[model samples]
Target chain A: MRIAVDCMGGDHGPSVTLPACQAFLTAHPDVELVLVGTADALAPAAAWPRCTLVTASEVVAMDDPVEVALRRKRDSSMRVAITQVKPDATGLTRADACVSAGNTGALMAVARYILKTFDGIDRPAIAAMLPNSTGGFTKVLDLGANVDCSAEHLLQFAIMGSALVAALDGKNAPTVGLLNIGEEDIKGSEVIKRAGELLRQAGAAGLINFQGNVEGNDIFKGTTDLVVCDGFVGNVALKTAEGLASMISGFIKAEFTRNAWTRIVALVALPVLNRFKGRVDYRRYGGATLLGLRGLVFKAHGSSDAFAFQNALQRAYDAARNRMLDQVRDRVVSALQAMPAAPDTARQAA
Target chain B: MRIAVDCMGGDHGPSVTLPACQAFLTAHPDVELVLVGTADALAPAAAWPRCTLVTASEVVAMDDPVEVALRRKRDSSMRVAITQVKPDATGLTRADACVSAGNTGALMAVARYILKTFDGIDRPAIAAMLPNSTGGFTKVLDLGANVDCSAEHLLQFAIMGSALVAALDGKNAPTVGLLNIGEEDIKGSEVIKRAGELLRQAGAAGLINFQGNVEGNDIFKGTTDLVVCDGFVGNVALKTAEGLASMISGFIKAEFTRNAWTRIVALVALPVLNRFKGRVDYRRYGGATLLGLRGLVFKAHGSSDAFAFQNALQRAYDAARNRMLDQVRDRVVSALQAMPAAPDTARQAA
Candidate 1:
């Protein structure tokens, strides 16, 4: 399997990605590693016989527009990385994946443009995997895909997220939920209200396990296997979740480090503390996947280090090996094809 | 000082309020507590001589409408307690403060109706005293009052929050920040953008200590004394914070109680943990006050226990004695009088 890694991505970049790639290669001797970026930009320590380098003169800064970067910056690392995955050129096995730890927008755009979307999917969504109290990962989609969304788009996301979770976690027809302000059916705005009805109809028909609305507070409660929402609210919820986790962890560390006695106590609690840390660690899940795409693309956090980068590459490899994209396509096609077309308003009223 | 405690509010109602009042009376020895609710409903609780019972026969449920409860439920505990604040037919202060552990909307309505808005203040925001790493409380306003907001309203909240922080923490000219998606000038929506400009003008002109825009992650950093935003975002942020605190604390307790070895570690960490718990304890700050009102009206959490209720009462008494409302009104009037009205074209441009 050939896994493409963007060497110019993330805060640590080559320093982190290089070591992660080397580590991954050492473990998976059969898997080939392709590092994309200018040789001058990469760390001296990264020069290895097993790792092949694809030179790209430029780098896409985190703030650059994804579409503009893809079109104008022909020699950019991100574009170069995606170019290698243009299914027609590589003859690379369908069992291959592309990973990037760069601007999420760039990664999403490149993936959508290069890999394309599935049969009935309007917009692709990113599903962030978070740990639940049940010791499993819950898939939350559209962390920040399209800022504005419609009911139909949300429904597509739900179906796609459910498929991803099923393919990844082996949870067939995983329970899907629409994230809203409240749990009641009549709780959200017009878009959510319509989406809730659609989900209910779909769930009743057994296409997906649509568990009603889940609120912000209930995200970590492990109530649903898959949660879907538009990018606006989803971004807010995701960032808020990240902020809260950091805040709590910071408070704990600060409190323990304040005095000598508390510091001692902190030391004593290390084993149990590590266990809890491992439970909430995002590194365990690696990176967020832009589902509904025709090819495998994984987006690692921009600030990720070597450990997280390696985990992201591994996740991408797993998705490729598991044929996640193909499975999603098949399931989505079946789901959409099974549904009846829009009925005439007059006839429906009658 | 006389504080009217809503004995028919909250889930526990009299069960929590009565004990809280009794405890406060025993501790203070001088403050008078007035219990507002049906005599039958409140009589079952253990009573204290310093507490006076004012019968309010009607009760408003948690899910009831704010305006309807305020108007139709005239004899409800919230309205009754708030009514005790006004000068009676005899023209004397019946109660110096009003306290309620009830539906937040109802409390806000009754408080606004009875106390009225302070001069130059359009809306009275709900201000929460949150725990900070500084071992003190940072005042946050508009926690969930108005979902849709404007720059002008956010400016008013900032002014009010600044004054409240000064009154509570003795931080004269407290720094106020506008919460946004990011810290950069171009990071937020139009509302936040306009608010940031206005606040910068206000700060530069010496009306407030406006600290510019702050991201969601910075709230717990204790960088600003007062954080202001629209009710919708603030409400979500507040709930998110509460949920996070509960989750972390629950996780800690669960881990510590898991086994005998962990139990020994818990014992070793008990002293430090208790201190940490005390620092983040919501009960200590009591209830949040409805700022920018003409008189003191505070709303305790609906699920608050006796300790929280008592702290709410104490907070109301302190605000009343300090004449916080009057101070806030004076400052707001001064600021408004001093601020130059933007030119007609500027208003249109805005």
Candidate 2:
């Protein structure tokens, strides 16, 4: 398998990317990496076996305007790495998948522009695997793709999410949760209510397993294998979870170091703390995938260290190797075909 | 000051409510509580010096529909308790404030029907005090009140939230963070972006301290004293935070009791763990207040025990004693009068 990497992206750029690639290559001897960036910076790491360099002159700054990254910097490493996944002359994909740690807006814009959206997907959604109490993960989307989504769009997200989870988790019929403010049938906005109905109908047809409305707490409870919501809500929930986890971790540390007796206790308590930390760490979950696209694209956190970035690469590799994209395409078609016909005269009338 | 208590609300109802009221009365030397519920159920608690009981025949079940609570159960304990704050004669407010540990929908419905909304406030927002890294708390609003809000309504939330923090946190010009998917000016949905502009204009006019756009993680970091968002996003973020905290706490306990060695460590680390737990405890921050109303009404967690319910009473007492309702009223008027006059040609051109 060949994977493309945006070597000039993220906080540490080549420094972190090169070392992580080397580790990844060592771990997966059968896999090769096409490192895309300024060749000079990445030349030192190209000596590794099965690793090749693809030069891209420009680098998308973390703070760059989306237009500048997409329009002005045509040769940006982020864009170049994504293009590597586009098929070559003989109809074979140049790179099976692509990974980037650049500005999310820029990366999404460039990828959407180059690879285009999937046939039935109105817009590609961002999916992140979140850790839950069940020791399993719940795949959530759109983490921050389109800010607003209609019921039809959310149905598309549900279908795409089910496909991705099924492919990754090896579950033939993963349950999908429609994230909402309340679990009641009468709760939520108009679009959310409509989305719930669509999911139910699709579930009844055996296209996907639709769990009824789920609240935010349900995400961490592992109530559903996949949770679907519009980008705005999903992104806020995802980030808020991160913030709280960090805050709690900080509180734990501060308490452990308060005094001599507490410091001594910290020594004995180190293992438990580490265990708790490991469970909530984002690095273990790796990068978020930009799903519902023609080609596979993964986004690493801009500040991810080598280990974290490597986890992202491994996740992307797993997605590509497991053919999540193919599953999504097939499932999207089936779900759409299975959708119940709409009521012809459903509008409120005299 | 006298506070009204809905003794028949919440998951535990009278069993938990009575004990909590007893604790609150014992802790405060001068404060009195008018416990509203079935006289048979609250008779034992009325023996205290200044404690009183007002009989109410009905109880609002946690699962009761809003209409049932508002229109059907007129003599329900929740409704009767809230009415204690209504002026009886000579335009004097009876009880300082009211609190309930009942169905949120039911409580809000009854409160709105009886207390009414503050002038110029389109709707009341649910404000919850969330623990932050700064050791203080951040007040977030519209947790699940108005599912879909106009930008104008969000601006109103910001104004009310600022007033809340100023009254409670005692900050002269508490910074208000407009929750969004991203921190950039151009990011987020159209409504969020418009809310940003409205907040900015309000800030420039000395109505608030707008800190621009903030992501979900900023909430825990306590980057701003208050964060305002539409109900949908706020509710998701709040619940997500709660779920994650509970999950983490669970993880900590499980890890500490994993084996003999871990158990020994847990014994040594008991103090640290207790301190950590206290810092993140939901009960410490109290309950969510129904803001933008003429009278203060707090909604305790449905399953709150005596400790949690008492915290709710204390928070409500603080709000009432500090005259939060009056402060919110004053701030809303000031903000409305300070709004910039619209340009004559600013409306969509013909």
Candidate 3:
């Protein structure tokens, strides 16, 4: 399997991605890496075995706008890497999947422009797994992909999310929960209420396993295999979790290093503290998949180190090997065909 | 200042509230307490100094629906306590403010029914202070009060939240941030975008210290003194934070108690760990204030213990003493007067 890597993306650029690529290639003997970056950035990977270097002239900055990445920088590394996944005139693709650790907005825009979404899907959604209390992870979708989603759009998210989870976790018919402020069916805004109805209908039709409504706390409680919400709410919840984790860890560090005596105690409890930190570390989760597109594309955190970026590469390889794109296409086709004849009327009635 | 206590509410009922009342009374000798509950529940508080016991026939269950609390349980302890803050025929209130640790929905419903909202404010909002890294609290509003809010409603929330911070924290010109998915002006849904425009207008008119747009992480970063959003988004963010905290603490405990060796280390590091826990404890932040109403009402967490309940009472006492209601009234009147004549048109343009 050939996977394209955006070597010049992320905050540290080559310093992080190069080492991650080396580690990933060592671990997977059957996988080949197509390193895309400027000549200076790709020089380190030139001698690597089973690696093909494809040089680009430009690099997308971490803070560059979508327009700059999409229109201005035609030969940017991120765009070049994504182009490797796009099929040519003969329907032959150079890489099975693509991975990038760059600006999220720019990456999404460039990916969508190069390899448009599937026929049944209107927009691609961002899906990521958050660690849950059951020693497992819960996959949440629409994480800032499309802020304003219709009921039909949410139903599509559920179907696509189910396929992605099934492909990655080998969990067929993963249970899906519609995220809301309350668990009751009557709660939330008009859009959420409508989405709940659509999800329940989809469940009845055996398109996806819909498990009624769930509150934000349920995301970490392992109440369902997947949680679906509008991108706006999902993004806020994700960022809020990130912020809280940072604050709690900061507080722990401050307390441990407050006094010389406390520092001694911290030294004694180093093993316990490291174990606790490992369990909640976001880097271990790897990357977020941009689902519903024609090809597989994973977005690593912009500030990812070598370890995190390697995990993203592994995630993309696993998804591609498991035929995630085929799974999504099949699910979307069947789900859309099974939808009601007058979905708009049904939403209005709801 | 006199504060009414609903002894029959919350998970522990009188067991928690009675002790909290006693502690509050001891802390403030000049403040009086009006204990409202069933006759049996108020028996312990009858002999307390500077306390008045008012008998109510019914009690609101923690799981009771809003309709039941608002209509069926007219004499519920939660209702009776809120009634103490309502004006009588002679325009004299029995208590300056009321505190309840009950079902949040029922508390808001009953409080709104008894006290009603101010003229310029369309709906009441739940405002609570979240601990920030700066060691100060960021006050967030519309936390599960109104699921759907208009641009004008968001403006009202900013005004009320500002007054609330000024009254409780003594920060006269606290900055207000409109919560959105992104910091950019063109980001987020239509409602959020319109709310941003209205907030900027309010800032220009000197009605509020609006700080443009802020993301969810800003709540903990202390980027602004106040964060305003629709109840749906705010509630999800708050609960998401709560869920994350629980998971992290649980992970820490599990790690410490995994085996004998870790347990020994935990024993030596007990003080540092305890200090870390205390820093993120939600109980220390006390209760959420029901803002934009004519009378003052605070809702503590339903599962609050005596310590948490005492903090809630202290918050209520402080707000009452500082004349929070008058401050909110003045701010709302001035803000509404400064608003554009065609708010709907302005929203359309946005």
Candidate 4:
């Protein structure tokens, strides 16, 4: 199996990416790593025979516009990294997965441009796998993809998300929840109300598991396996969770240092603190995937270190090995076809 | 200052409200408490000579609809507590401030009916006070009063929020920020975009200290004194913050009880934990005021205990002392008048 790595991506760039590639190769002797970036920038850090270097001089800045980065910066590391996955004359350039810890917009744009969106998909949704208290990870879709969405788009997201859960967590028809303000049947905006009806009808038809309505506060409550929403709400929810977690940790640290006795206690409980930190750490989960694309592409955090980058590679490897792309495509196609097209007016009247 | 307390509100009702009143009276010598509830309910609790019991027999259930609670339950304690502030024949029942920890929907309805919306104000926004990491608190308006909001309503909320912060926080002109997804020249939906322009124009005209923009994650960052948004986003952000805080506290408790060493450390760190809890607890800060009304009305959490209920009364007393209602009315009326009249050309442009 082969994976393309963007060595010039993320804050640390090759400093983290090169070491991550070496670490992954050490764990999997048969896996090949194709590092994409300028050769001189990576040569000092990467010293492995199994790793092949592909030079790309251009680099997309963290603040660059998504459209500009995708269309104008064709020679950038992210673009080159994804391009390596495209089938050549003999299909030798085809990679199992592509990993980049760069600007999220750049990564999504590059992926969509190179791999293209799947049939019946207008926009690709970014899905983040969060480890819940229920002993498995829950998939939250459209982390920051399409800001404006329709009920049909949300329904499509639900179908795609369920297939993703099946591919990643081995859950069949995972419970799908439409994120809203309340759990009541009459809650949420007009769009959400329509989405709920569609979800219920689809669920009744056995397309996906549609749990009624999940509120923003219940993201971590483990009520549903897949929480679906438009990009605007999803992005705010994701960022708010991140901010709150950081605030709480900061509060704990300040509390422990306010007094001498507590400081000593903090020293003794360092191991427990580390354990708790590890559980909530996003780096361990690697990166989010831009689902509904024809090929596997992952977006790691911009500030990811070697461990985080390596985790991204590993997650990408797993996605490739599990044939996630094929499963998503097949499930979505079949789900769309199996859907009874607007049950007769008489059935609706009933 | 005399504060009217709904002794029959909240989940614990007089059991919590009465003790809170007594505690406040014990701590604060100057303030007088007026308990509004049935005599039978107050009989079980302590009866102080300084505290006057106003007989209000009806009670609004936590799950009752807002219309029913306001219209049908005329003699409800929540209604009686608020009506005491309305202008009577001789204007004798007017309270300095009135507080209730009962159903929030009912409080909003009753407050609007009795206190009435300020001139040019369409609705009263629920401005919740949140704690910042540095010190004090930040004022956020329209928590969940009106879910679907227009640009004009949000502009009104911003004006009211700014005035409240200036009155309560002692800032001459507290900075007002439009709660948005990002801090770009042009971002967010059409409504937010229009609100941003309105705020900018309003700020330039010296009505408020309107800061450019604030993201959802910036609420706890203490970047601005007043953050304003429509009810939908505001509600989501508020609930998400509360949920995350609760989750973190729960996680910390679970972490400190894993084994013997952690338990020893927890014992040593109990004081620190208490201090941290104090900083995050909103009950100590008192209730959130319903701004843009002619009278001072505050809503406390329905599940509030004695301490929480007492804090609500204190909040009411503070609002009364500062004469926040009058200031809001005067500033809002002046600002609305100063705003450029509705443009026929602008409507055509949209």
Q: Please identify model 2 stretches exceeding 4 Å from their true place.
A: A338-350, B339-350
Give the higher-TM-score candidate: 1 or 3.
3
Q: What is the DockQ for all candidates, taken in turn?
A: 0.23, 0.53, 0.56, 0.35
**In DockQ, how does model 2 score against the reference complex?**
0.53
**Cα lDDT listed for each candidate:** 0.76, 0.86, 0.88, 0.78
- Residue-level lDDT of model 2, residues B1-350, one tens digit each, is 99999999999999999999888988998898889999898888866778778999999999998889888899999999999887765857668899899998888878888988876776788999898899989899888877767777888888899889988978879999999888878878777888788889888888988999898999999999999988888889999988898888888889999999899888888878998899998887759989988788999999899999999999999998788888998998887776533222111000
Stretches > 4 Å off in candidate 1: A41-50, A63-72, A89-95, A109-123, A145-153, A185-208, A230-232, A254-264, A292-294, A330-350, B44-49, B65-68, B86-93, B110-124, B194-207, B331-350
Q: Write the per-residue lDDT of candidate 2 for residues A1-350, one digit (tens) a residue.
A: 99999999998899998889999998998899999999698879767789778898999999898889878999889998999898776767878999988888788888888988776677778899989999899899888877767787788888899889988989998989999988887788877888898888888888889989898999999999999998889889998998998898899889988999899888878878888889888888859999878889999998999999999999899999999888988987776566543322211000
The sequence of per-residue lDDT tens digits that candidate 3 reaches over residues A62-174 is 87877898899999999999999999999889999999998888888888889998877777889999999888999999898787678877888899999988998899999
Docking quality band of candidate 2, CAPRI definitions: medium
Sort all candidates by TM-score, best to worst: 3, 2, 4, 1
Write the number of the candidate with greater TM-score, choosing between 3 and 4.
Answer: 3
Q: Highest DockQ: give the candidate number.
A: 3
lDDT of 3 by residue, B219-255 (tens): 9989999999888889899998998898888899999
Q: What TM-score do all the candidates reach, one by one?
A: 0.86, 0.96, 0.96, 0.92
Clashing pairs in 2: B10-B101
Interface RMSD of each: 7.5, 7.3, 5.5, 7.0
Q: Which ten residues in a row have the lowest lDDT in candidate 1 chain A?
A: A341-350
